[model samples]
Target: MPETPKKLTIATRASRLALWQAEHVRDRLQELYPLCEVGLLTMTTRGDQILDRSLSKVGGKGLFVKELETALLDGRADLAVHSLKDVPVDLHSPFALSVVLERDDPRDAFVSNGYGSMDELPAGAVVGTSSLRREAQIRQRHPGLVVQPLRGNLDTRLGKLDRGDYAAIILAAAGLRRLGLEARIRGYLPVEQSLPAAGQGALGIEVLEARADMHAWLAPLADPATTACALAERAVSRVLGGSCQVPLAAYAQVQGGTLAVDALVAEPDGSVIIRARAAGPVADAAALGERVAQDLLAKGARPILDRLSMPDASA
Candidate 1:
């Protein structure tokens, strides 16, 4: 192990859930090195400030982490914590996702005040979600229901549903469980019905790529199984050039020394979807993910992806 630092600071967004995630890292670090001091440096991100427009329209999910990255760049913090799902697969030079913590539920939660499940909602009922992946899946499964753009932190989203802006809302079960708000989830959407976004429900620690010592210090928190699964899922996203502008989903799981990956590309309106699946030895997880991506592309997903990437694309 590298020599322990005397103090460590984590950069995180100021949202309640962001703080919780950062604090979780801090607590873990403190437990790992009892003599070292741990603290948090919180700031508002553009992703949090710009709620008027969808993330796909404003700038994609990178809006959530650029400021945090800036903090690491300027030495304001040693590391950053994030929801792995929000971290782009093509994260560039100088920044690296050092490690992924153990995963949580990795399933979408269905929350509604009066309804027990999505099937209970009547026609024309509005369901709010900020994810194009979730919106596309909902539209495909419940064509009679209305899907709308929802923005803001977990609390704000729940408040919107409470105030009746939406008849229901979809969220990651992990976030609610982390914040001790699991009671709010009426039911969980199975992976078969709504495949998770890449790295969903997992927490990742980011550091400057050159910080070998920093990676060493944080190594204890890494979960081997989750890391393998996440790497495989991210590989699929990387090959597909995935972003919020595209309704894409990738999920992977490791079981009994094998890794299975599932990925898909869909029309934004959910009118068309192409899916692929592949499995291989855990050591070949990334290769399996690449194979799945190629399968999706070969099975008629290329045109759907091309149409969405057009300048004035509207589905």
Candidate 2:
């Protein structure tokens, strides 16, 4: 371990859920080094400020992270805690994903106002979600139901659903559990039914690459199983060149010493779906993801992916 710093600061978004995750990290760090101090620096990002359009239309991977990265670069914060799903695979130089905490429920939650489950919901009902992955699966399984784009902070999204704008909404089960709103979940979407987004339910610590001391301090917080699974899952996305615009899902599970990964690519309207799976020793997780991605491409996912072009990110 490197020499512990006397004090450290964490940068985070100001949403209720983001604050909770940051505070959790602060508490754990304090518990580990009783003498050291930890504090939070909360700020709103452009992602949080813009809610009128689809995030995939506005931007995706970096909107939630770039502001926090600036804070780290300017020395305003020692590190930032994030939902690993929001972190881009092609992180710029000098920034490293230093640690990933243990994962929570890595499944999508089905929440509705009056429905007990999917079967109980009437045909042609409206369902809301911020994720392309969720939307694609919902359309595939419930073609009669109307899918609408719903985006905002957790509370904001829930409020929209409550206003009857949607018959129900889909959210990550982990967020609901963290906010003590698990009671609102009518059901858990099975992994077989809805594969999770890569890095869906894990919290990651990002720090400057040169900060060896910070890396050492954060290393102890990493959950090896979650880390391996996330790496493999992310590998699939990396290979497929996925962004929010693409309806892609990748999930990995580790058993004993082996890692298995599943990946999906689908049309934006859910008109078609393509899938691939591969497994190998845990040590070859990234390679396993690559193999799966290759399989998907060879099996006709390339045309599906090519349709979801990266718009001028600068636009």
lDDT of 2 at 39: 95
lDDT of 1 by residue, 100-213 (tens): 999999999999999999999999999999988998889999999999999999999999999999999999999999999999999999999999999999999999999999
List pairs with backbone clashes in candidate 2: none
| TM accuracy, model 2 | 0.98
Best by lDDT: 1
lDDT of 2 at 95: 98
Which window of 10 residues has the lowest lDDT sum in candidate 2? Answer: 306-315
> What value of lDDT does candidate 2 attain over all alpha carbons?
0.91
User: Which lDDT values do the candidates have, in the order given?
Assistant: 0.93, 0.91
Stretches off by above 4 angstroms in model 2 are 310-315
Summarize candidate 2's per-residue lDDT along 91-180 as a digit string, tens digits. Answer: 878899999999999999999998988778888899999988988888888888989989899999999989999999999999999999
Q: What is residue 230's positional error in candidate 2, in angstroms?
A: 0.8
